[model samples]
Target chain A: MSATYTAAATLPEALAALASGARPVAGGTDLVVGARQGKAPLPDSLVAIHGLAELRGIAETGGGGLRIGALVSHADLVAHPAVRERYTALADASAIVGSHATRHVGTLGGNVMNASPAMETGGPLICFGAEAVLVSESGERRVAVADLLTGPGRTAARPDELLVAIELPAAAGGSCYARLEYRRQMEIAVVGATCAVTLEGARIGSARVAITALTPRIVRVPDAESALAGGDGGAGAVQAAGDAAAAAAQPISDVRASADYRRAMAAVIARRAVTAAIARARGSSDSVPIPASPALHGADRD
Target chain B: MRYDAVLNVNGTDFPVEIEPHRSLLSVVRTELGMPGSKEGCDDSECGACMMLLDGRPVNSCSYLALQADGRKIVTVEGLADGGELHPLQRQFLAQGGVQCGFCTPGMLISAKALLDQNPAPSEDEIRIALSGNLCRCTGYQGIVRAVQAAAAEIA
Candidate 1:
């Protein structure tokens, strides 16, 4: 197991190394866990990007959208004041992505590049109209985040390409990402939905919805988006949009969730997410991400 | 595949070489002789093996010793200063946060990181933050109280 270890000081250097056949490692949370369980082989070389703190931040970008660096952690997502305030849906999605420990080390870029259908980054990112920024030895290009994932644990990214950053367009200031998972931390999403909506005086202007884990790749249900456009952004509208989104999904049977159950939860969660986004758009910026404040501790199961 | 890597554990640096198959938990207990971080599950789900990796809690059982190269790490044994218990360590004892004592170190590390970032986090926030770490005894009531109590102390 002779592996070349490289610590990238900049994104360009990292991209170049990746193009030259070096394995890119960021945070190494997911990859490490899988490796520990013998589910993967440690690549001969590990290009560590944890040293590049520049790639780990949440801030308002010059382009008027939120630019989440590849190294941003789940904890960083929850703790960032800017993220918790405006794009809280992203934070909410990050909070339940894993346990406190896992969240601290898991990187958003890793989640995106890993391309798991139930990837925590997929739904919320899609909700925000996020773009995937890829870099190569030749140059750099941007792709829609929705277009990045091809299927479960698959991506359209070239083997020699490295995902550098995730650019999420500012969705007129209100958005929400939600999903149903069997376990709060360990389970993958059964059906994930991201909704971004802009409201003009109780009337919805435009809406974007991306559903993950319930299909081959995350697909926007335009029929559901239409249901949310002219409606009052009220409970009924949200429910209808969720129903359409669920109806529009082409989920497969898997261990985590049945197709029927996923379809049902797809509607339920999409409606809930859209409703939540609308509520945030109405100025509930300080709303907490969790459902209940009750404290529950883990008791030993073994 | 053994290579000498610098591991900054509990503030001090130690040069060590380990097999790629070795876990950080085993390294901490055997090589370094710091056993505060337990290896209850040998899996990532249990917080019993939690430690601070660059100020963030991570399960050491699933963590390879090679991953700690040139990184700062903190174990439960490092929580005290000059033989004095950390507030969380002391508070866990006061509130019976430790029933089985197996999950205490991991719980404390997770709670410590949470409090380090958020000093006055709400009860629900505490639960959500520490949900991944498991405690078999006391049904987590005392553990949650211990975290809340520690938060109060830190505040």
Candidate 2:
């Protein structure tokens, strides 16, 4: 049980609380739920930062990118027009995060800091080359999203530091995030993949492929990207990229699926993501829905 | 250690001292003496403890009571206005949405939250909105029908 609690009204106050060894709670979805599940007890000293107004809103940067506050909820991201148009992969990932309630309260900062390998937004953030702005009492520093996430349920950030915002570079072309799930709502990814490709006329200019729930940390697959880049973005290239993703997967057996099953499904999910991303890049945006998992499943029948 | 805070629940203020780890569901039920919201699962997986915090649906089971200080909260008991039952309540009964009454409060709260934001929701939208609330007794067809009926009544 926690012995102390302080609801910080400002950013500096929250940072000071963190500097004083108080764990920050935003939305409390993961921290409180993890406590109930016996994964970890509530922190001895807690600071509620949900009331900090400075840590809210999504603003367009001068460089045509986005500067998303830590308190920006998944629901907000899904409803943002820029996210739907320019960052479709992020929209696809955030649209399917938990139920309506979870999306309403679960913030992007909480999700990124949680560092779950199977988290919906991690793959897309990595593929977009996002950066995490960590604020401390003394100073602020930015780290690439790929490097900030050290492992599952762990981050490279110190306890005294707070992740204030995520910075995304200007994006072009199309991207998609597709996950394998048993049910629609309140489900974690069994195996997932995010593919972002920029087309250069008839050929693929560049591609980034990241696999989720198939490794200790969500990481880009260089072999998979190499197979897709400089290709004609055809079925054969997509299939080869999928196969390379499967070859790079190092999964673990859990209640969701066996390691072998996850490895096998990695190729399928990766292929679906690649196919949908290519379709979007080709201006057939309606080919796949915002949340592409169910649409991809529906397409399997057709 | 406990902290003194006030929860503005259903337009009424209830000042109480609560522990930092206590959830809003427990504080609402135990301190405020309102048992309308049931605790099906202490974890957030089950939405039996759903409530509207500042007009947004939240799983009270996982929401810290202290964080809700000075915030408006609406539980199932607050759905009806005085003597007359809310349209959602009446429609839920008319559509046979209630079974064992275990998931009724949560379903009502979730439906109310949906209709407040989206006054006219499609059947698929209602289903997606209430996906957090689970009811094993009714196969969810009746609940879906109830939400649809209530939406029409309100519209």
What digit string (tens of lDDT, one per residue) describes model 1 on residues A1-302? 46666667887777767777878776666777777667777677667677676676766888778888888888788888777776677888787777878777788888888787777668777777788888777777899887888776688888778776788775575777777765566546778888878887888888888787888777888988899887788777887898899898898887777888888888877876787788787776534453411123342211
Off by over 4 Å in 1: A10-13, A286-302, B19-23, B153-155
* Model 1 CAPRI quality: medium
Model 1 clash number: 5
Q: In model 2, what is the error at residue A141, expressed in angstroms? A: 0.6
Error of 1 at A199 (Å): 1.7
Steric collisions counted per model: 5, 0
Which docking class does model 2 fall in?
medium
Q: Report the C-alpha displacement of residue B2, candidate 1, in angstroms.
A: 3.3
Clashing pairs in model 2, backbone N/Cα/C closer than 3 A? none
B125 in model 1: Cα distance from truth in Å? Answer: 2.8
Q: Name the best candidate (by DockQ).
A: 2
Q: lDDT tens digits, residues A1-302, model 2?
A: 44899999899999999999999999999899999999989998999999888889999999999999999999999999898778888988888888777888899999999899999999999999999999999999999999999999999999999999999999999899989987667777899999999999989999999999999999999999999999999889999999999999999999989999999999999998998888888887642234435464364511
